[model samples]
Target: MAKILVVEDNEDINEILKNLLLGEHQVIQAYSGTEATLLFKQEIFDLVLLDIMLPGKDGGQVLQEIRQSSQVPVLMITAIGDKQSVTQYLLNGANDYITKPFDGDEVKARIQVQLRQTMSQELAGSKRQEYGHIELDSQTFTVSGPLGQVSLRKKEYDIFQLLLDHPKQIFTKEKLYEQIWQDVYLPGDNTLNAHLSNLRKKLKEVDDCHEYIETIWGLGIRLKEWQSS
Candidate 1:
């Protein structure tokens, strides 16, 4: 059973969610955004059910903070159903969302979907693969080299994996964003760039002397040719 963190300010709603998920999963409750953040840092939960309207930091702020350090699945709980609001939540990294006065079965279904996806990714590649001196352990979601090792967030890992799997193949920003985010790429969207930048930084930390990813000014991005001293 997965461990889930439930963050909601309304006592009644929080209790209802706990009751619904209790038998199938372990649930932790947080009444305010501040408390949710603190609990999240203290525990490693498989999923988070965060309410967009909260007392302390609000759901948007909490989501931003979580994305900074983790790639754990988060299902937003929002009363707002407008297209713009939902779009913002997804772009900000929520895996999914449940509207207020939600149907119990629908909530359960959405949660299951996210959990299943996470499990699938975890079990995708059991063996380690390498390029140059850098190694990727799919099971552990980590990359290591002679210099050091570091764990990568989901997006960062996916970007690296795609490039490593197809060395020398250039992937344009649009292609990368679509494949990684599973959404249409939008102009001026910095999501892919930010993740790529973070991935490059981690690779540099692992092996500083040789670059692993190369950016072709007008073409795209590809794995750098492995060079040996």
Candidate 2:
């Protein structure tokens, strides 16, 4: 089941969406854009159903904010089926658009498409794994670290996922290359270091003080054990 955030001010529309999506997914409702934004930061949503016309910070603005940190699928709901609005939302990073006068079947279909795409991506990775304060969704390429949810590139995600999956085992640079790149690890090659640097930087962005990935001199890399203290 997916965790969906439905942002619509119209009480009737919100109810309809909740009713339509309740059975298959966990639905969270936000009557205004501000509420939506707050809930978004406080929760992890699989997909977002956003209405364009809202009280303060419309759907477009919310989409823009979400794009700053997330690539979660956003399906815009609009009564205005104009080319300009559609183009604007798409350019701003909305995954798809849904016109108002909601059709139950169409809503389900569109949601299915988004979720299916997400599932396929996740399947491309291994599975969901967690360690310490970090949780990695291989399917979604999202890592919930100390700071917040950060979306990762494919290679970074695969590397993190591998480490999370085998937290107790240290993976050498060559092994990581063989596992993730499916290629030989050559000496004097900086590919692994570059990716590892980027991955560490991303994690540090979430929590700078704690080292998430530890480089063991001549050994390999492993996640530091979560210290609750």
Candidate 3:
């Protein structure tokens, strides 16, 4: 059963949610945003049912804070969901939005979807990434090949991990900068280029034959597929 945090200010609605999910999952309750955040920090929950309007910290603020640390699935609970509010919530990292006076079946179905997706990602993350003859042990922060194993510095590993995790997904310089460095991308910043150069050098040292990171000219970078015999 999944562990879920239900954050709603109204006692009646909170109890309704708890009762609906009680038999299927473990429900942890919080009546305010501050209380919810505190509970979230203290325990690891599989999913969060968060109300958009709350006392202390709003759901959007709570979600932003949560994104900084964990990628736990969040279903935003809203009483008044305008288009702008929904867009803003999604852009800020909420998995889905549920308007208030919810349907029990709909909430359950959405929760199940998020739970399944999160489980898939967690399972994938537990396995080491392999491309061609190279194995990247994200757990150990090491890349190994027939030549030898090389330890990656934090930034090098972060950059490599991003591409390795997504495989063929091309990431633009700006996206890489924002995701990795958590900073705005400036046109003149050579920081990403420098890191890519260092990362490539390290990879080449381990295995010279394969070119792993592909530069798509003015577009971005992606992991190249290794040819089979």
Candidate 4:
């Protein structure tokens, strides 16, 4: 079962979502955009059900902020006939949209679709590996941390996966370059660092107990040992 974060402000609707999700997965609620962003950084969630008319920061703004730092799937909840709102939110980066006055079954179906897509994409990317205090599920392409598990973008996890796949093996930048991006003919040096930075930051978020990735002076990187240097 996946962990879902419900970001709706309405008490009745929140209760309905709670009941709808209770048996299958863990669900947490955040009533405002501010709360959602804070919880998002503090913990991992599989999907975010965001209401467009939320107080404090609104759905679009919250979605923007999340996309800036995370790739978690977001499904926007809008009002009836709110085509403009849906369009605007999508342009703003929502994974999917469900209108207001929604049927219970429809809500569940849409959520399932997004979750399924998220899972599918993950499975296609990562291969089984253990990095630091984290576990990577290659079949599902998800990463599990101390708090819970969450999905990651391909490039981000691929970099970490490579190091973990061969723990303590020194992989030069060229080797890592060949493995992850498949070629060194494109974005250049800055590109690799950008992805590595993202992986390191996210892994730290998952488990702050240790640093799993270690840079090897002027050569490359290696997955560090769990107990000691």
Candidate 5:
């Protein structure tokens, strides 16, 4: 099971998503933009179900904040979605999106897709990294920990594979966004934090020490030499 953060002002939608997703994953809800950003700074989540029309900071602002520091997958939730709105959020840095009155099965499918992608990235390990316990055989596209194995989503595999390819070097969020997401914006958001949380969690499941991912404080995150195989 994975952890999800739901950022929406409407109580009804929050409850709906909670009920729909609670069966397969843990759900955390935030009523407003402020609350959502707070939870993001404090915990790790696999995906974020974010709404655009929110109190205080609003959805756009909240998304902006998240993108600055996180790389966690974000799926924008909306009531009034259009081509322009979709383009705006995508350009701002959202992985996927859905309009309101959506199907529960569709949400589940999307969530599963993201989770599976994450699982894949974990197994792939790092580039040139044939580590113990956690083995990522890129050729076969399989990630096997001591316990089991899984496949990675396209985006997750791309960014994670890049890090594994260069375990020692620190790739700034801007660089990562450009390299992975293909763009950059000012001040940044928690997008990097979101992705890091997922990355760290995967590492822990296979290797509790999780030394492969190290935070350099203000600089960025990278894998430790001793931790890498």
Candidate 6:
């Protein structure tokens, strides 16, 4: 069952969501945005249902905070149904939004869709994979590229595998550390940087001309555009 956080200031609405989700999933309720923020830091939830009009640190602000360190699926709850508002929410990082007076079935369906997508992504890298000139073998924890094949340490292998799994997606350092280490990512931690450095060096040794990973300064890392060498 997925762990979901329900952030709604309306007592009735919060209780309604809890009742709707209780039997199918684990639900945590927060009455205000501030409470939701604290709860988020304490737990790793599979999805978040957040109300836009919150008591403190409105939903948009909270979303920015979450995006800084995570890519968790967030479904916004908003009373406004204007196209501009919905567009803004999407641009600001909400996976989806439910209008006020929402239909129960639609809410449930949207939640399911987001959860399924998350599960699919998690399972996508569970096999041998390839991208550009690099190939990763899950069974042996080895990577082969144009130049040669090399066995990687567990952490190194995981880092490379994740990059290969989503070559076009930029992974923030926080997201990488949290996923690979299965722990909270502390700011300024050098461990992920060290592993990435080692991983890059190993890849370079195998294929110097092809840049496999590119760091977007002040943002994250993603696979560089492949070039014919």
- Residues 22-41 of candidate 4: C-alpha lDDT, one tens digit per residue: 88879999899999989987
For model 3, residues 61-121, the per-residue Cα lDDT tens digits are 8898889767899999998848897888998899998887889999999999999998778
Candidate 2 runs further than 4 Å off: 126-229
- Residues 68-116 of candidate 6 have per-residue lDDT tens digits of 6578899999998688988898999999999999898899999999999
lDDT tens digits by residue: candidate 1, 1-229: 9999999999999999999999999999999999999998788899999999999899999999999777899999988869799889999999999999999999999999999999988787476998888899888789999888999987798889999889979999999888777778999998888888899999999998889899999999999999886
Task: Go through the candidates in order and give each one's C-alpha lDDT.
Answer: 0.92, 0.87, 0.89, 0.81, 0.77, 0.88
Q: Name the weakest run of 10 consecutive residues (lDDT summed) in model 4.
A: 180-189
Clashing pairs in 4: none
Better of 2 and 3 by TM-score: 2
Q: Which candidate is the best by lDDT?
A: 1
lDDT of 1 at 122: 78
Return the lDDT, model 2, position 71.
81
Clashes of 3: 0
- Model 4 deviation from the true structure expressed as Cα RMSD, one decimal place: 9.1
Clashing pairs in 3: none
Q: Could you tell me how far off, in angstroms, the CA of residue 15 lies in candidate 2 after the best superposition? A: 0.4
Backbone Cα, N, C clashes tallied per candidate: 0, 1, 0, 0, 25, 0
What candidate 1 gets wrong by more than 4 Å, as runs, is: 125-229
Higher-scoring candidate on TM-score, 1 or 5: 1
- Residue ranges of candidate 6 with Cα displaced over 4 Å: 127-229
* lDDT (Cα, 0-100) at 153 in candidate 2: 75
Which 10 residues in a row give candidate 3 its minimum summed lDDT? 118-127
Query: Between prediction 2 and prediction 4, which has the larger TM-score?
Result: 4
Top TM-score prediction, candidate number: 4
